[model samples]
Target: MDKAISFEQVTHTYQANTPYAQNALADVSLVIPNNSFTAIIGHTGSGKSTLVQHINALLKPTKGSVQVLGKVITSATTNKNLKAFRQHVGMVFQFPEKQLFEETVIKDIMFGPKNYGVSDADAQQAAKSAMKLVGLDESLAEKSPFDLSGGQMRRVAIAGVLAMKPEILILDEPTAGLDPRGHKEIMDLAQQLHDKDQMTIILVTHQMDDVVNYASQVVVMDEGKIVKTGTAAEIFADPGWVYKMQLNLPSSAEFAQKLVDSGVPIGKLPLTIDQLATKISQLVAEGADTDE
Candidate 1:
């Protein structure tokens, strides 16, 4: 697959000359495959957010390089295609309510397309489409965004970014404070975008369940550096790193590991509840046959 974004030996520090200067990212390198769903997981201050901001040129790397849509971010010359680059790589920040300044949700979502020189009618159409993708009703479009509940506001904010019709959507802690239902709703919306639109998604989250179910690739970070990168099964099968990261595995995965440790003859490591049930049923059948 082609790369939508790439980082080469990138390093960044905040307040470079001050005593408060802290290394935010260190020698981080990564390639985000086009049209894939990749999750960046780390505890707070792990550089996951810093690395993602660099993808869309929101943050410049202090050392090494960042390339988005084939354009180098730190090049000496200005990029004439920056607007296009940003249009293709949309970012939905955490607590999007803080960014909602328009009188109505419709106007807020339309802002992006309007700035890109789209006609008013076209921008409205784009706003409606984005609202639908984020599971917002058309009726809410005309209402003031601030009047909505937290979850509604969150989706509205996401719809605003979606209005840009970005090919690569980057989200920073999108589900942070949502209830379980709201969390599932956003995850489903993301999956819909990936499956239907084939949009490359880079999700920065601390939710392991979301990571297990939704991510095609998982990138683990620690103390401003990339610690591990692999598929869900590859990374979750080893509970050591999961423990070290101070993270939890999917419920079924933890159960499966415990059963294996107790010599329960599990066929394989199961990452979901359904898979665990199936494995247990198979184990029971095998024991019955042996008894016969």
Candidate 2:
């Protein structure tokens, strides 16, 4: 598969050269495939956030380099040259709704494109299309973003990034602080973007269920180093390692293990509820045949 981003021997140190200097990333090398739904997971302060910031040059690598969507970014890379490259990578930070500042929803969504030198007419058109994509009605265009509910405010914030027409979307705990329903909505939207728009999604999250449900590939990090990278099934097949690293198993995986412990013979460890249900049904049918 084609690669969306590559980090080569990258190291990022905070408060460099000072007594407080700490290595957030150490010799980290990774390649995120183009159009893949990838989840980056680890405990807090495990470099999950630091690794992703390099995707759009938001944080430069103190050593080595990061190449994103064919654009190379090094410690020496200048900001002026990154504007065009950044358009391809849209980042929705945690609590993105806090960033909304324009007087109206339309104006807020239009901010990104306009900042990139797009004209008012074109920017507004993009903004409208983005709003529609996020399931926001065109009628909401006139209302202030703050006037909307927490969920609506979030949708507005996401629409702002969509207006940039990014090829790769980075979500940093996008569903944090949401109620269960709102959590599903955001996850479904991420899935929709990956499916219909063919956008590569880099999701940094702690929710193991979201990882199993939405991400095809999983990257595990610890102590500023990548511990493992594999398909969600491959990663979760053995729950021991995940737990050893202080990571929670997906709800399905945990429940599947309990059923297995009860001698249910759940063949292989499944990553999601739907898969576990199918496995149990297959076992039941086999047992009925044996009874005959």
Candidate 3:
């Protein structure tokens, strides 16, 4: 698969030249496959947020480079000519609903495209389309964004980014404070974009269940470096390493481990509850047939 984003030995430093100067990223090399649902996971201060910020040049590498959509961003790369390139990468920051400040839902959603030089008519149409894509009702277009529920506000914020029609979407802990339903809704929206729109998705999250359920690729980070990159199953295969990294196992995986310890004969660990149930059922059926 083609790469939607590539980081070559990238390092980002904050507060350079001061006592607080710290490396948020260190010698990071990664390639995110085009149209893939990739998740970056780690404990607090593990550089998950710092990593995704590079996709849209929100934080340029202090050393090395980031190539996204064929545009290279380095420390020397200036924003003067980044408009076209940046337009292709949309970032939905943590608490994106907090970014919504427009008087109406449609207006908030239209801001991004309009700022990108789209005409009002075209921007409005894009906003409407994006709203529908994010599961927002057309009737809410004229409603003040502040009047919406937290989940609806978040959808409006995401619709705003979707209006720009980015080729790659970077979500920084998109489900941070949402309720169970909201979390699933946002995740489903991301899957739809990846599957139907062929959009590359890079998500930074602490939710292991979300990683197991949604992410096709997982990157584990620590301190300021990329520790490992593999499928979710591969990442979770070694429970010892996962715990050593201070990362929580997905709930289903934890339960499966207990069953395995009890001599359940589980060959492969199940990452989700549904997978665990299916495996147990199959084992039960096999045992019943043997007894018969």
Whole-model lDDT, model 2: 0.94
User: For model 1, what is the alpha-carbon lDDT of residue 38?
Assistant: 98
lDDT of 1 by residue, 3-90 (tens): 9888899888888779999889999899889899999988788888888988887778878898877888873426576777788889
Of the two candidates 1 and 2, the one with more favorable TM-score, higher being better, is: 2
Poorest 10 consecutive residues by lDDT, candidate 1: 74-83
- 1 or 2: which has the higher lDDT? 2
When 1 and 3 are scored with TM-score, the better candidate is 3
> Which prediction has the highest lDDT against the true structure?
2
TM-score each candidate: 0.91, 0.95, 0.95
lDDT by residue (1-292, candidate 2, tens digit) is 6998999999999999999999999999999999999999999999999999999899999999998888888889999988888899999999999999999999999999999999999999999999999999999999999999899999999999999999999999999999998899989999999999999999999999999899988999999999999988888877888898899989888988898889888778887889878888898899999999
Prediction 1 global C-alpha lDDT: 0.88
Would you list the C-alpha lDDT of every candidate in the order shown?
A: 0.88, 0.94, 0.93
Query: In model 3, which regions exceed 4 Å deviation?
Result: 286-292
Could you tell me which residue pairs clash in candidate 1?
none
How would the candidate models be sorted by lDDT, starting from the highest?
A: 2, 3, 1
